[model samples]
Target: MLKEQFKQLAIGVAAFTFSCATAKAATTITVAVTPTAANAIVDLVADFVNANPTYDVAVVGSSDSLSKDAIVAGGATGPYDLLLAQSYSVPANLKYYYPTLVSGDPFPFAKDTLVLYSTTVDISQGIPLQLQAFSLPDPATADPYGVAAVQALGPEYLYAQGQSLTIKTADAGGSYAQVAYLGTAYGFTGKSQICTAVTNVDQYEPGSFHHEYVLGQDYTTDIVLAGVKIARTRTVDQETALTAFVNFLVSAKATALQHHCYKLPSAQ
Candidate 1:
């Protein structure tokens, strides 16, 4: 009877040990993404979790400038394991972080172009005079789309007419929302945002809007969407999980998913 009790105790101890090991093997990776890519990142995370059942993924979406600031300041150590930002801003903003917060070079995943959006404009008639106010992303704050939008309004462009334009700066998502639902007459944002607005009009403003490609005339400025991995601030297992997630983001499947919202790099 004593031997039987010892055998049962050993079995229980072994089972508990196995459970602990399994729990330790499971990892969670957090990703910080720009507001423009929020929806697409959510979908990509869902697909990644499906393929990697042992790993859990979380996504936080914010402005490009804010996201870069968080990672560079080491605020992302406990919150985010990776960051997705505009390619134009990455090199300049992330250079200081180096191998500590930023693992390596940014991987270009997609591209976006600046465009004009309006709910009350008749594009067939060309630039309208009633379009007095414009919503744009803040170029000073590291928004490449905003910079492109400003370039599109240069003297060389057709819209550089004598009419004075009122410009309001906002983030990518905010810029889109201003045109789609906030009753802004003209909004400047990425073409991908226009695609998102058109694809989900009913879900957003439930109204008709027009989008025109204005930046094509000025190709000096381009927007590329890229992803960068955060430094290994967590356990080695967690670092491996984070690396895997970043690799999956550049995979063909992930690129296809990104193309649904933004233009791919190769498509440029």
Candidate 2:
């Protein structure tokens, strides 16, 4: 009976040791991104984790103010080790906020085109002459895509942007919802969201296809995304893991994923 008890105790200790080792082997870092890049970041983080088992990346979607506020609030050793925002301005802004905390130029990753899409009506007429009611991201907000959408519509339609009848939301996802689900005439959204229709994906499938008008330089503003590696006091393991993930983001595979349906930073 004593021998059996001894054997059980040995197994318990072994299990605890193994568990502790497994936990130590893994290092996690957070990458705060704007909502426009959330899906792309998720896919990219998945690839990074699969390649480096020692690292786990957490993706957080932030608004313009919230994005910078989070890092500033966290200080030098913040939760966000990296930041991927809708435009290159983010890095510049960070530099202004805390010069020492931000190092190096922001990496231009991808450019997302703004698109006008509709399922309930025809938009082939080009920019609508008038809208009884419309849906869009609030142009007043600092969201790059939303501002680009307003710029695409031009001054004649500025009132339409703030009209009481229009539906305004936070990000591209909400703009998509206004038209895709809520049936709000037509709306503006990111090209990445609708590129390459997938099976059973709502509004992107064969049956629920949306008529899309791709707005290029002739119609809309350029929407490029950039990421900046933040400098923070971290453990050696965490810093190494963070460097590896950032390197992977610029890798060929990651670049392709980031540019899926969008322009490569180098391309434009």
Please name the candidate that would achieve the greatest TM-score relative to the true structure: 2
> Tens digits of per-residue lDDT for model 2 on 1-268?
2112122221211111001112363366767777656656666776677777767667676654576876777778776788887777767789776877765778877777777767667764545766757666677775667777776767645677467656777767677666666667877777666553223222333333344445565456567788887876677887888889878876565743443365565544
Question: Model 1: which ten-residue window has the lowest total lDDT?
Answer: 12-21
How well is each residue in 98-122 modelled by candidate 1, as lDDT tens digits?
5556677777877776667666664
Q: Which pairs clash (backbone N, Cα, C closer than 3 Å) in model 2?
A: none
Model 2 Cα RMSD, Å? 12.3
- lDDT per prediction? 0.60, 0.64
RMSD of each: 14.2, 12.3
The runs of at least 3 residues in candidate 2 whose Cα sits more than 4 Å from the true structure, single-residue gaps closed, are 1-26, 159-165, 197-203, 207-216, 255-260
Candidate 1 Cα misplacement greater than 4 A, ranges: 1-26, 75-77, 124-126, 156-164, 196-207, 214-216, 266-268
TM-score result, candidate 1: 0.74
